[model samples]
Target: MAEAFKFELVSPERLLVSEEVAQVVVPGSEGQFTMLKGHAPFMTTMRPGVIEVTGQSGTVSRIFVRGGFADASPAGLTVLAEMAVPVQDLKAEQIAREIKNAEEDVADAGSDETKRVAQEKLDQLREVQAALGAPAAH
Candidate 1:
């Protein structure tokens, strides 16, 4: 039998997932990282990307997270994401629309600071869209 560890994914609105998984891959700010049973303890910031988990049943699932942090230890892994959704629930069209809107806002902003902020938001959206298998906006 494969070793399993507790995996919990949470968002502000609700707890999206909680279960024992054989392995989990998280999008760390430094880079992509994976966790398995009896892994070393560490903490790191998460980036906008897909979180993939493989369960003991040999089933694989994916979750889209905007940003967050992860805590890992010998016991398990806990991911506190600011926003997360099941990959199936993500709509590519909606994401594309958001990217367009953000781009327009960046262009229309009157001040440099505002434009910079909008551009940052647009970048985040693009990253999320990319993780969903959608082409990134130019």
Candidate 2:
């Protein structure tokens, strides 16, 4: 059997997952990474994407996470997510609306920094839309 490592996924609303998993794939800011038992210690800011967790029972769980912090160690992996939901529960239209709001934010920014941040958000939202099999944002 594969070694089990502690994995926790948290959102402001609730503790969504607390389990021992064989491995977990996380969406880091730089790119996606997989954590397994005895992974080296590290920390990173995550981006909006799917987190795939493979459990000891051989079941896989897919969760969507929207930006946050992730910590890894030999002992466990923890994710403090800004927002999280089961991937199967996400709505494509809802993500599209967020993309529209991000577009407005870019337009309404009062400074270059704000516009840059909004544009990054728009980019992430577009990725989510793509994951949902939705058409590209106009």
Candidate 3:
């Protein structure tokens, strides 16, 4: 059996999860990485993606995060997210709506820089939608 470590998931609104976990997969800006007990200490900014958490009992929970930061230390792993929601709680309609809104933001951008940023956001939203198996926005 894998050793368990403390894990916490925090959003701006509230603490989402705090418990012992066997493993956690984080979506870092550079790439995805997994955390386990006795992991080397490090911190990395996250991208828009899903975080997969494995509990001591082997149950897996997935949380979708818009953006965030993750830290792995001797103490444990902590994720501070800009926005986080349980994958089970997310609906297809909600993802579609977000994608539509992101597309509109891209279209409404007035400057080249603004357009690029908006496009990046739109791309990320589409990726999330695909990951969730949500229908494409109308």
> Which one is best on TM-score?
2
Q: Rank the candidates by lDDT, best first.
A: 3, 2, 1
TM-score of each: 0.78, 0.90, 0.88
lDDT of 3 by residue, 1-138 (tens): 689999999999999999999999998988899999999999999988899999999999999988889999999999999889999999888778777877898899999999997887778888989988888887
Q: Whole-model lDDT, candidate 3?
A: 0.91
Cα-based lDDT at residue 90, candidate 1? 78
Better of 2 and 3 by TM-score: 2
lDDT of 2 by residue, 83-121 (tens): 998988888776777788889999999999999988997
Best model number under lDDT: 3
Candidate 1 vs candidate 3: which has greater lDDT?
A: 3
What is the overall TM-score of model 2 with all chains considered together?
0.90
* Model 1 lDDT tens row, 64-124: 8877999998879999998888889878776777789889999899999999878876887
Error of 3 at 47 (Å): 1.2
lDDT of each: 0.86, 0.89, 0.91
Whole-model lDDT, model 2: 0.89
Please give the RMSD to the true structure for each candidate, in Å: 3.4, 1.6, 1.7
